[model samples]
Target: MTAATQTPMLAARNLSCVRGTQTLFTDLSLQLDAGQWLYLQGENGAGKTSLLRILAGLALPAAGSVHWQAQPISNQRSEYHADMLYLGHHASLKEDLTLTENLRSLIAMDGLKVSDAAIQDALTRMGLAKRQHLPARVLSAGQKRRGLLVRLLLRPAKLWLLDEPFNALDANAIVDLQECLKAHLKDGGMIVLTSHQTPDLGSDTAGFVLSLSRGRA
Candidate 1:
């Protein structure tokens, strides 16, 4: 690809992570260009979540670096964060707040202005429109997941870092979420996610896989 087309939205170089005494992975490198999707596969304790966090700039790597759009994330933290969204195992929603309230709060916290109509549109896209007035504490696992996913539509982020996004989702919800992700990628957005189950999103995008095992004692 030409230089104009060679720039990646996100890239990692020789990233090595250490959690306590455990070495998660070493010399890890990846490049996510626009409209691409990456699937991370590993055993339960293989540090997949840690890797995602590092890419999201939530945690620093023990060694090496992460770059967002050719700029070091360490130096351009705010700019990088402005263009990315990180959704972890915890949904980061207020249990006491209604679904709409939570979404509005998140958008405000991000310093982005979103209209109420847009918020409702996002909720409807995630299949949570009818329940938008209900507190998150009363929602089912899948509904809660849907409520969290509504952010994807409400905000404009170039990259999405999701950790086990399919958790607690039923088959139908899974399909719906897959479509949501597909639409994101189709719009030149990139995604990196870890999943125990395979993603059958029906897209022809290539994915890079990484696995980690304990070193010999």
Candidate 2:
């Protein structure tokens, strides 16, 4: 099939990861298409986070290759970085900077030009408008999480890689995040996240479940 006919926005072939003589997994393969979501389910130290880093091009897999839009990611590193967003366990925001400033820096790093008004709009959507001027270090845990989430709106990328996005979030914040994710998928963005809690999004939303134990068992 031609690249245009391939529905998957991201794909992995014979992917294997290893750390210090520990082989996390081998021959792991998956596909993520626009308007779809995938959940990485596993126990602690199951390499879920490592796999995500590899997919985001933050780290290299011990073997195999990753493809974005039918092109090998390694062949177009700069282009891949521009098209993917990866949020890990630690928020990338600067603790000393105000929420708005942190977001402004992030946008600048991505080499995108956005207006101040656009930044404010994204913060508002993530429920951080009222605290936009406050130092991110002083915000409550949930508010800090929301600050990180503002990236979703301020910058538009085709792929989202989230690791425990709901960490430190209250029930309401979790619900709000679920809504944001739903809207993202509806807009044809693909998501791959690792969460311990059951997802609030429904099963019909182009979902898949990958468990580390499946192959080991």
Candidate 3:
């Protein structure tokens, strides 16, 4: 294959974190190539969210570095962000804005614009078509999860860092998202996420998981 077609890779080395003098974890390292889905598993207080935050560049690792395509992400901040997407446990949507409005604003932040029809379609697929006009504050926790997931359909990225992505999704919504992830992997996207629910991807895909616990005993 040509260089243009080669998939990208994300790597992290010697990552560690601390919370109020409590050492979470250390010496963590991993690499994810395009078309791979990484699942993070751990008990509560195992620093799963903290690890995801560091990898997403939302937080600094106490003693490590992250790289994309062999280049330190810090040296290429904007370029890295342009191709990376991070979705925290919270929806990150504005309660004052309707579903479509929130999505519109998110896209605009990336210097892109989508039509109302496009926004509605994404919401419809995520089972939020009926609530597209409703303010986000009125949506239940589950609905808020689905609403935030609608962003995935609206924007495509090379790397996705999701924390507890399947937390509030229902049976059908979970299935829909699993399929969406499979397709993203098929398209050579790299996803490093934390999900308690085991995603059922087709046999044709490649993925793995890393379990996080406390520091070495």
Candidate 4:
């Protein structure tokens, strides 16, 4: 008998993007399976962020489709979103809300129920224990980014779509996030992230890189 092939957790086929008159990319395809990471690399205006947005269902592709579990994402928006987490380049936090409150709101918006204690723990892990109760308006850029990253631990998602997750992070925070990514991959999660700088996932980790400059996978 022939061996059984595993279905990818996330897949994009022949995706094309256009912003006004400029064509960012075309015929782009990629697959991400459990325990794997796809690092997207390209220069500015290369559509790395656009492609990530398309995968997250925040925007549609000009051509082709994105699939989750081999099913077109358009057919199962709720389920797909529940299992995927997308953090864009910005902090996207409400300045009026405390860091803890912002995180709780995001969790509630996602329709996932996590305990207050769990949320606190995630924040603590992100090194925001002391500042968790402070309003986001007063936190530094790095603090806001760290607070946003707390969702990684609290979310029950299997796929992560992050754009420049390392931005504004200090050296220690970057290492902490790298550890978090490694831990997620260890547990059979999939990740697709765009970063201008190459991510250090250790010397032995298995992953792939797709450059938007090539215009296709």
Candidate 5:
């Protein structure tokens, strides 16, 4: 089926979150279907990261609930997680492992098996082929970011939830990532990400920012 006719991949109903007596957001709700994109805009302490964690099934919301494909994410966590990719600001990469090893380890957790040539090709495209054998701890900040991004290329899951993905990326890398995101959307993949800096996703792209402070899109 085409993305336009498919059910929403993610849905949150009357969600609320409070951290240490501080209400980050309350009575918030949103839905994301296939082939759509969501950009989160908020300042520090506005709960952008917190909300992303909640949606990604990593944190519990203070109130309300989220569903994946009409099933509560908590109940269908395995299925939900299998079809999603959550990229945090600091991706949990093993510092001692080389970039290639890290990518293989992470992908394997999702029950995916990829060939070495394919993985090497993806690293090469990220401009990391030469450094793939080096430990992630020794890589530069931008190189580490690029290494984590390789997960996106290897596993084109249905839902992509990225937190501060543009941080530490250079101008050219940023542009390349934007094009990659556009291609994913065109393939009926959905994405929800936060970026402090504005992104130019080409003139034909369809996207809108979901400002967290007001819980408005």
Candidate 6:
């Protein structure tokens, strides 16, 4: 395709967000292609999560538009969402369900066809091999986060939108996450994430940072 007609993997143009009387950001734009990641950085209450929600199609921007493969996200909600995965800061788990059961159900909710063996392997890789049978209520915060991260192993989404993915992670878990991210980028996946801690996706991955402050980015 010619350069002028080429579509970006993801693009946000002149986005504006307002909560109550406060305008969090205005006229912000971003573009990401395969093998690239964008990091969202800001202080407390800078609308990082709000911006992520907008990009995920969970919330509406006050102005401007978001496009997936050059189509407005609102116009292609299902197709766009099918290729995107959004994970909030908190782990979404059923307190009464075991980690294994929770992972199974979550994958099912996405309509993914993953085998039990794959789930087991992902759990083991996340360092929850022994704890997979334990209820989420009994696991530590870090373990719960790891359980949620197992989706990254099973889901084949082209774009990943994560909010505070590194929260509650230990040193080893952090390293593991970095490796996972590196692999995702290597496979030509796009990622947008909000985090207080800077991510080290090694030296090869192309990563950019968008710093958000009150009413601007």
Q: What RMSD does each model have against the real structure?
A: 2.7, 2.7, 3.4, 2.8, 2.8, 2.3
Residue 141: error of model 2 in Å?
Answer: 2.3
Which candidate number has the best TM-score? 6
Worst 10 residues of 3 by lDDT: 1-10
Q: Give the clash count for each candidate.
A: 0, 0, 0, 0, 0, 0
Model 4 lDDT-worst window of ten? 1-10
| Model 3 lDDT per residue over 142-216, tens place | 999998888888886888888888988888888899889888888899788887777677778777778887763
Candidate 2's residue-wise lDDT over 1-217, tens digit each?
1123454779988899888888889999888888888888899889889989999988999999999988999999989888899999887889999998998988998899999999999888777889999888899887888899888887888899999999989888788889889988988998999999868786657777888752341
Q: What TM-score do all the candidates reach, one by one?
A: 0.93, 0.93, 0.93, 0.95, 0.93, 0.96
Model 6 lDDT tens row, 1-217: 1123367889889999999999999999888988999999999999999999999999999999999999999999889988999999878999999998998888888787789999999999999999988899999999999999998988889999999999999999999999999999999998999988999998888888889987778
Mind giving the per-residue lDDT tens digits that candidate 5 earns over 93-180?
Answer: 8999999999998888878899989999999999999999999999999999999998899996899999988999998899889989
Per-residue lDDT value at 136 in model 1:
93
Q: In candidate 3, which residue ranges exceed 4 Å CA deviation?
A: 1-8
Model 6 alpha-carbon drift over 4 Å, by segment: 1-5
Q: Higher-TM-score candidate among 2 and 6?
A: 6
In order, candidate lDDTs are 0.84, 0.86, 0.84, 0.89, 0.86, 0.91
lDDT at position 132, candidate 6? 89
Q: At residue 202, give the lDDT of candidate 3.
A: 75
State model 5's lDDT: 0.86
Among these predictions, the greatest lDDT belongs to: 6
**lDDT-best of 1 and 5:** 5
